[model samples]
Target: MEQWKKNLAVLWVGQFLVMAGMTMIIPFLSLYLQTDLGLSDPHETATWAGIIFAGNFVTSFLFQPLWGKLSDRYGRKMMLLRSGFGMAIVMVLMGFAQNPWHLLLLRMVNGTISGFNPASVSLISATTPKERMGFAMGTLQSGGIAGTILGPFIGGLLADAIGFRPIFYVTGLLLFLASLLAMFVVKESFDRTKAAAKPNVSIIQGFASLSRIPQLKSLFAVTFLIQFAMIGPMPLMPLYVQELHGTAVNLAFWSGLVGSAAGLSNMVSSPLLGRLSDRIGQERILLVSLIGSALLFIPQAMAGSVWQLLVLRFLQGVFLGGLIPSVNALIRKHTPDGMESRSFSFNSSTLSLGNMIGPIVGGVISGWIGIEGVFITSAVLFVLNALWVNRTLLAHRKQRQG
Candidate 1:
């Protein structure tokens, strides 16, 4: 295989490991907080879980651009190593946490060093051919989605077998192994001398330069909105499952199945949509996905059974599979040469921003109007994003035709 192809394969595994480690806690976070950490009050436990979960994203959003600037100055591979190793250590430390506050602090620190996803995206963007950007991004996304789909299932088994704390140790070890793979296998052609020769721009300057590009600016906005809408229902999903399935013997298992359903279809569909985008255009795939996903969310909000919700979520994943790959490919297409890494970094920050804010908003919406309201809110946001993309991007089609 060619070098870019080789990078994609190795980085695909790297993405899987990183994402799995990150997502493995999703299924049993409350269990860990309540059972392992000795929290008695249900409301306090829920609040703590939300805090611990959101803390990582809060720091990650603030720090990603800084890392991106550093990657532009150093190299993408080194940044990957930095994140991989740092996250590995943090994951291990979480297993040893004596209390909720300890775990919360460690999570905050983990966010400070989180950039593996963006670093990998930068490496792939730099190396892959422009014509195959969509396919490359989609395939890369599939690895993470696969991990996300499997993490909770595996985590549940492990939690039952070895217990909750051990899960963190295993996850951390896998991340370390992933880092080792990246350190030895992945190669990049960064030249520090040339990077130094270029006038060094401050991190803010770097962000400013990219923001000034109209297409990049618009793409960034759409990326944020997309994440906001998609993730808005996540924090409340287990409760929604409970509301649908009711308190039962297998409540946890059913919730895990519901959570993994969307990821399964997303993993199956991402690469296919990406290839189609490569042939036709990313804009077209993105438009259809935005509209389709918007419509799909409505049925999910109105789903009468857990099975119905599962099926709706799976289809929702099928439509949204094209979303991120298209966004990344569009960024790669619009970014100035030599600045791809920074552009991806900014894009990653928006993603982190969505991750941070989406759950909070979802939590508030779920509290105010109930869990179903969160899905309705997500549907509305998706429709608005579709309109935004149509207004901003499709207008270019007319200009090109004229």
Candidate 2:
């Protein structure tokens, strides 16, 4: 097999393990605060949980560009290992935390060091053939989605069987193992001498250089909106399920199904849409997907039954799967040579920013106008995103052709 193919294969597993380890704590984070850390007040436990959870994204959002610049200077594989191993140590330390502050601090540190996903993306984008970029990004996305879908479920189960602290240890072990696998198996053709030969630029200059390109700027916006729309409604989903189900029995089970439905379909469809985009155009797929997802959200807002919402979310995921891979492919196509990692890193920063803000905005919107309004609002955002794509990407293609 080709070296790029081997890199993709190993990195896919690495992405899966890394994502799974990161998300494994979510199912019982508040429980850990209450039981182990001795937070007596329910409100305090909830607040600490939110803070600790968002702590990672806060630092990650701020520092991703720095890592991106360094990756361009050094090598993407080195950045990947740095993140993988750094996060491994952080995860293990969380298991030994005696207070919520310790966990919060560790999570922030983990975020500061976190770059595994973006590093893997940079490496893959650097190595994969232009024609295969869509397929590679899509396949890689499916792996992460698969991990996200399963992580909470597995975490919840393990939390019951082996208890919470041990789950952290297990998560740390998984990350370590993934790093080991990458260190041994994944091969990058990055040229350190050539990379170092290029003049070093500040992170601000790198961002400015990339943002000057209209296409890349638009792709970054698309990345932000894609994540914003997807993650915004997630925290409210269980309440929405309860509303639709109109009962308490099996509520957890039904809620879990609703949560995983879109991810499951997304995992199935990303590669398919990616290959299709390769034949047609990434921009076209992206625009159509934005529109399709927007329309689906309108009905989801009005869904009267949990079953209806589940089905709509599943259908929506089919479209959502196309968004990121297409964005990544287009980013690679448009980014200037020698700036690929920084470009991808800036995009990752937007992603982290979206993840950090989406839930907060969603919660606020839900409070003001109910959960349904949040859905309608997200739909509107997607529509705006589609228009942005049309103006920036598709219109340019026509202009060049003409």
Best by lDDT: 2
Task: Specify the poorest-scoring 10-residue window by lDDT in model 1.
Answer: 392-401
Q: Model 2, which residues run further than 4 Å from truth?
A: none
CA lDDT for candidate 1 = 0.88
The positional error of residue 256 in candidate 1, measured at the CA in angstroms, is 2.2
Report lDDT per candidate.
0.88, 0.93
- Per-residue lDDT of 354-400 in model 2, one digit per residue for the tens? 99999999999999999999999999999999999999999998898
In model 2, pairs of residues that clash are: none
Instruction: Count backbone overlaps in model 1.
Output: 0
TM-scores of the models, in the order given: 0.94, 0.98
Error of 2 at 383 (Å): 0.7
Cα lDDT over the full model 2: 0.93
